[model samples]
Target chain A: MNINFTLNKKSVTIDVDPMKRLLDILREDFRLLGTKESCGEGECGACTVLLDGKPVTSCLVNAVHIDGKEVMTSEGIAKEPIGKLLIDCFDETNAVQCGFCFPGFLVTSYHYVKTDGEKNLNKIKKALSGNICRCTGYQKIFESVMLACERKPLMNANER
Target chain B: MLDINCQYKSVEVSGKKEINMKFYKPKSLLELFETSEKIEGKKYFLAGGTDINVQIKNGMIKDEPIIFLNHLTELKNILQSDNHIIIGALTSFSEILESELLKNKLPFFQNSLKNFASPLIQTTATIGGNIANGSPTADIVPLLLILDAKLKLFSKSKLREVPISEFYLGYKKFILKRNEIIGAVLIPENAETGYETFYKKIGSRKALYIAKLAIAGLKKISNNKIEEIKLAVGSLNEYPRRLFKVEEYLKNKLVNEIDFADVEHFLQKEITPITDLRSDKEYRYRVCINLIRTFLNQ
Candidate 1:
């Protein structure tokens, strides 16, 4: 089947099998290797992607659902404010340790900072609850997410 | 051991003609029903696949064609009426958790979902799939039973509504026909009158932990008398169960007369739980009885 969607803000098309995971589509077909897959069953959010601006586990999600949708993969998020803030904050806090969890953490933290940027410590913890970081014990990662919220001036203006 | 099947098919998304996906996508519910109907055996339905994805990754589902129900538009509405609210079959747990309608109709139905699955799982898991899966510990089952919910099952040509109590036949079983789809769930709107309610789930972990024992209660305390009491307990039986003998005993009893000890006696005979990885039979039997006393004190 032929699948078309906006990836990294560019419209593109790919032909792949029906059962193919989005992780495979990004890596094998699109040649975007930044998105990794571990525990491909969706338990590990290593395959996280922004489906229409919301972070989701890409591995468990079938490519069929991406029709015409704007998916901001970790590769695509560099231009967005939420994504940029996370990147800056991660480096500041030494948040990425071995970095196997980088893509998932980046996507998860992007959405968290975008949605709940009040710097409410509890909200940050709750929002990133799904993004598991076995390496850093999460203190620095949590600090990075909080720092990202602080850096986003636009997110605060729109905060409810 | 369960046979595993993994032959996947491509489906087309309706209305979005310009873009397409490689994965199997049925353009319509009719096609989904027809395709699933023809499969001889062991074909499974994949809605959100939050619970089943783990099973699939472990090769629990081998090469059988999985019927993905994500594109079914008919299962995505929350229609309301004077008598009841009809939540479409595909209505997601995430939607339900954040819905104003669910909060109004049955508050706990939405609140309990906070612990239904992980936030990621809730984003994809559907309410219909949860009930249809027939897991005794399904977070919504006890709440649905307490709400006196009913299901509208749809087949190729007919639709019928069945009360939630009669819906589950046993463990991992329901009275649904092969062709029937659980189209909607019907729940009463004004049933909260004079009713004091509580929902409790004891879990090993806060998020994504399936409850070892979950229970819900609704009591209609009228003028110091227990006009009615409904008890729905999960993870303690083959399927989530309604404790009639206990409910019947509590009804019409004075509020204080129905003390903690009395409630304990009734609960002891109510649940017949089995041992599983999450819990032991003896522990369930002992803890469940004590939970009643705790609930009453609360």
Candidate 2:
């Protein structure tokens, strides 16, 4: 099966099995390894990706289902404003202890802030609830998410 | 930031495509049946891809010739007809949760929707998949049972509506045929809403826990009396079982004069739950009893 979709503001096509998970396609085919996978059974949100600007676990989303759907991965840090801000805040807040869960965490936070502009703490926590983090206690990650929201507008300016 | 258009045609399923495997997204059910008739190895109708993908990935499902169903716009709509609330089987839980008609008319269904995995899962999970999966824990099934939901199935150029009570045969089993796809769910309109309704799911923590034991009860309250009661519990038995004996005893009981002895006695005798990996039978049973008491008190 062949699928064509936009990635990081560019269009690319790939030929693969329809049943392959979008998670593997993004990593193996597109080489966007930043999208992490933990508890591949959708129980954990470590594989979250923004599907059409909403956070969803790419592990659960099949390659066939994403036919023409837009998928944003951690590799889009420079292209996507939230990605860049999240990266900087993650570094500053020392939330990168074992960074495996960083990609899913970043994508989830990005979708949350983008969709809900106001920095409501309660909503932010709810949005990031799906993505799980292993190291660097969630307090630091939550701080980083808050910090990213603060810097997102400026970082988005860089995109212009 | 990944925004893909749906206009691009669907590609084939990922596998050793040594054979001429086809990827068919029929816009209508007729076309779907035609494709299903011709499908070769391991045919599967894809909706939401929530459980199907997971099951396939886990190797629990090794044979499924995929048939994509999200493109069937006709199956993804919700409409109200003369006497029933018609929800296309493929209509998403999120759509149902957001539907004004569903919220206003079907509170039991709405309560079940609220406990659905999360915003992300709810976005793509469909009612059809819930019934088709037939897990003892399928949230929608028990709610549908309480609401007297009916299923409309289309296959072999014929259509049939099966009442929700008789829809599932067993665990991971349904009355569907080889070429059948759930067309729509016909829930009887005018369900009484004044009844004191209860929906309680005892899962690990919250968020994504499958119900260890979930209970849904509808008790008609009139002049401080329990006029009629319908109680159903899921993840308790092979499937969600109606506690008919309990309901039978509760009927016409004065709410204020309600003796805890009668309800508890009937509840203990009605449900036969099994211990599973999710929880122990003792916990489920005790929790359900507490729920019945709490609900009655409410």
Candidate 3:
């Protein structure tokens, strides 16, 4: 099946099996390797991506579903201002360890900062609850996102 | 770069095995029924593709044609009428949570389902898929059963309404026919008003864990006498069902005068929980009794 959709702000088309997973399509067809695949099932958020501005597990999304839809992987998010802010915060807080889960975390946290952008710990925990981290105990990750939320308003003002 | 190369090689090997499956995307609901009728072998509807995609990766579904239903926009809205709140079957859980109408009317449902399989899964898993899959442990089933929800079953020729309680015949077995698909779910408005609502999902973790056992309750007590009550249990029987005998036994009885021991006897008869991989039978039964006791005592 030939599927045409926007990938990371770019309009692209691919002829692949419609039943193929979005995760596989990104990594194999498009070579967007930032989205990891820890669990082939939807249990883990390692394959999380933005499908039309909503976070969804890529492994559970079929290639056919992405037809004419907008998809953004962590690689695309990293180029945005909010994504850069989150990365700086994560770097400052030393949140990366082993870093297998960081890409998924980055995408989910970027979403939180862009949409809700609250400094509340409970809300942050709930928003990132789907993505798991085996390293750093998640405290540093929370701090990094909270840092980004606190700095996001300032960044927006600067952009204006 | 080395890791990428290793992963790319594995994808090629798996891609060859998965390419045999065929996918059909119908432009309209009518086309869907017509296309499905022409297919000879087992075919599955791909709405949201949350469960079906996972089953495919696990090799449970192979070489079967999947009819894509996400494009059927007609079956994806939450509308309100004079007497009922009509929810299209393909309405995702996230969409339901964001609905102002549901939040205002069915606050209990919106609040309870906040932890339905994490925020990521909720974005793609539809309410119809949850019920159509007929899993006994489905998070939405117990809530729908207590809401007295009715399903609008659509076929090529006609549409019929069936109460959700009667929709299930056994474990993973439904009264839904081959040509029929769940069109919408009808929940009566004000059905939950002036009643105390309770929902508890006991799982291994707070998110991304299947329910070991779940209980949903609605009670209307007047002057310490039980006026109306509805209770349902999931993951504790062949299918999620209402505790009709228990509800009947407690109706019109003074709350202080009721004997829980007798109520337990009635509950034991209705639910036939078995030992499974997710939970133990004895534990499920005892926890259900305790939870029921707690709901009533409060």
- The candidate that wins on TM-score is 3
Q: Alpha carbon lDDT of residue B150, candidate 1?
A: 92
Candidate 2 second chain TM: 0.84
lDDT of 3 by residue, B147-249 (tens): 9999999988989999999999998889999879999999999868888999999988877888999999999988989999999999999889889999999
TM-score of each: 0.87, 0.87, 0.95
DockQ of candidates 1 onward, in order?
0.40, 0.29, 0.55
Evaluated against the true structure, the overall lDDT of model 1 is 0.75
Better by lDDT, candidate 3 or 2: 3
User: Residue B122 deviation, candidate 3, in Å?
Assistant: 0.9
The Cα error of candidate 1 at residue B202, in Å, is 1.8
The DockQ leader among the candidates is: 3
Model 2 misplaced regions, further than 4 Å: A148-160, B1-27, B38-43, B256-270
Candidate 2 local accuracy as lDDT?
0.75
Residue B90's C-alpha lDDT in candidate 2?
89
| Cα lDDT of model 3 by residue, A50-102, tens digit | 99999999988887789899999999999999988898999999999899899
| Candidate 2 lDDT, B1-298, residue by residue in tens | 1112232222234443223334566656677787788766567778888887677555665544567888677888878899789999889887898898877777667756676776667767888888787788888877777777789998867999888778777776778887887889988776646766788888776577789988887777778777778788899877777788887887887767877777778877866677889988888877887787788779
